[model samples]
Target: MLSSWLLVACGPSQEPPENSSLTLLHPNNPSSDTETYQTENDFDLLVSDYESTQRVIWQKPDLVIAQLGDLSGKTVADIGAGTGYFAFRLVPRAERVIAIDIDQRFINFMDSIKVRLPENVQDRFETRLGKPEDPLLKPSEADVVMLVNTYCFLENRIQYLKTLATGMKNEGELLIIDFKKNNLPVGPPTELKVSTAQVKAELEQAGFKVKKTDNQSLDYQYIIVATLQKPTNKIN
Candidate 1:
């Protein structure tokens, strides 16, 4: 057993709605950011859904893919994969894409969409309900682990990073794309934004070595490619 502290950003209670498919959860992952975000009811109306047009301009998904290097025959875990925004892009390139979200609603939404997608696309992707602390993925199973705009919201992020590496292969990479600390036209509140240097320092403390960083790849955010400083060093 990893830990019982898994949870969403502002997650569901220990027991989700009686009708919910989410039976594996504990509490919300605590964070120091004081800003507020969406709720369960908000998701029902697709409030969490990303805007494709804006994403094309701001996130530049295509550029992000190019930066990731080769994905052929790779296994990627898209942590906090809201509505499988990036997972859809990964499934076509990677051998497998495991979409994990603490919100079961997101997983269910992905399931609904997955059913309508082509069989080949469906075969390349999977959805798993995750806890805030644990991604619930097998040990050393992924070649690439990614998080897009998901880092600032996690509680005990340092601990989560320590736990996150367990799911990556010895030489695997961890990619994070998040909002910059500066004020932006579109993004989370300023207080919630985390600087790239801050993330780098935190990851370094958690036993990850920052390999590359690109500030211009995304309009309002930055990307970091880090490799696990392997040899199986676990943080106490």
Candidate 2:
């Protein structure tokens, strides 16, 4: 389920407090996008939308997670991890799970859930407040990066992917799952979505080689798996 948060592309309002260093990325506040989450009621509404039980029928989270293959000791970065719907599930599977979002409320919400998890699982999950222009992942810090129902809202995606690539290993994998450009019963408006073909082209421009694509698995979304292509005639 989409969190319906189209984070406006803007700089942070102010620097994070010096003592605040819990986020995996540089802490930054989202712009005044009151429409996204103006009040506690609004936040609660969005949370319910994202964590809806009916979502399981279409999202098929377990099948989606299996597409990443083994995760015994891998690190996964879940971009736009609204309410940790997918991030928390990755905690026990991946060695490290970075749940990232631009919205502070979502981060706080996920952190609340984190505290309730078992001690071992809690240690594996980390919430990150990211910037609109960058996810702020560390150099080669992620073995796999996933964006579910979160790609279409981005601005200047090619440039964003270039920045994201620097944070992934030389041959790290990137998995993107988003709504298809069709009038589906669920998901955002078709006009606001990105097609699988467009995603493949963008991945190529961003230096990733499309490895696999699954359009039939999910009812409303398409899956794309690409690997960061190593530089040719260039040193790492």
Candidate 3:
């Protein structure tokens, strides 16, 4: 279970009008990319916020674990794992959990956490520095690759999905959990939000098929699980 998202600052400033348009500054912009947002370390701040929020909002992490099916011996990858939230949750269940993030600082933090990991999960967790367009994992290396509440920040959805498909095993599953545009006060605004329909369509375009869509969570978010399709042309 991820954070409740209630920690978002809600001051007297009225929620931006429903259709309010705010300019989205791309993270990869050559000129403005180096400009930092908040002074606090982004990854650490995000992790602290999420950990606190989840404690307040979510009742069970088991629900998400169960939805992931069997991970007892699977090689799982958590893409955009800010503070290893999902990665840490999965390490006990998976044979190995590859926690990937675009920030090297986050990876370093994850490495620090590795020392105090439970005996069973001691050597099962590894961190990888990834980019927005590429996950950097070898092809067919994972039984599952998950993007939990992090898909919206991806600069290229189609390329990212394609990279994910290539990184997964033939029967692997990809789980994407994100906030519902209409309900969540946290995360990007509605205009920048990626809808369930948009996610499904994008995955399908990347040659994956929707295996399931579940709204079981009581929060303002949803989950979509998609399976990679067997390639038709084997003889290239």
Candidate maximizing lDDT = 2
Candidate 1 local distance difference test against the native? 0.73
> Per-residue alpha-carbon lDDT of model 2 for 2-52, expressed as tens digits?
223221112122322243221111112242234322422355545655676
Ranking by TM-score: 2, 3, 1
Count of clashes in candidate 2: 0
TM-score for each candidate, following the candidate numbering: 0.80, 0.82, 0.81
Q: Write the per-residue lDDT of candidate 1 for residues 50-95, one digit (tens) a residue.
A: 5233346557788887777899999999998887878988888899
Pick by lDDT: 1 or 2, better one? 2
lDDT (C-alpha, whole model) for all candidates = 0.73, 0.78, 0.71
- Whichever of 2 and 3 has more TM-score, that candidate is 2
**lDDT per residue (tens digit) for residues 94-200 in model 3:** 89999998877778878888888777677788899998789988989999988876787786788778877888889789988877877455554576668899999
Stronger candidate by lDDT (1 vs 3): 1
Q: What is the C-alpha RMSD of each candidate to the true structure, in Å?
A: 9.3, 9.3, 5.8
Q: Which residues of candidate 2, in runs, are more than 4 Å off?
A: 1-41, 232-236
Against the true structure, whose TM-score is highest? 2
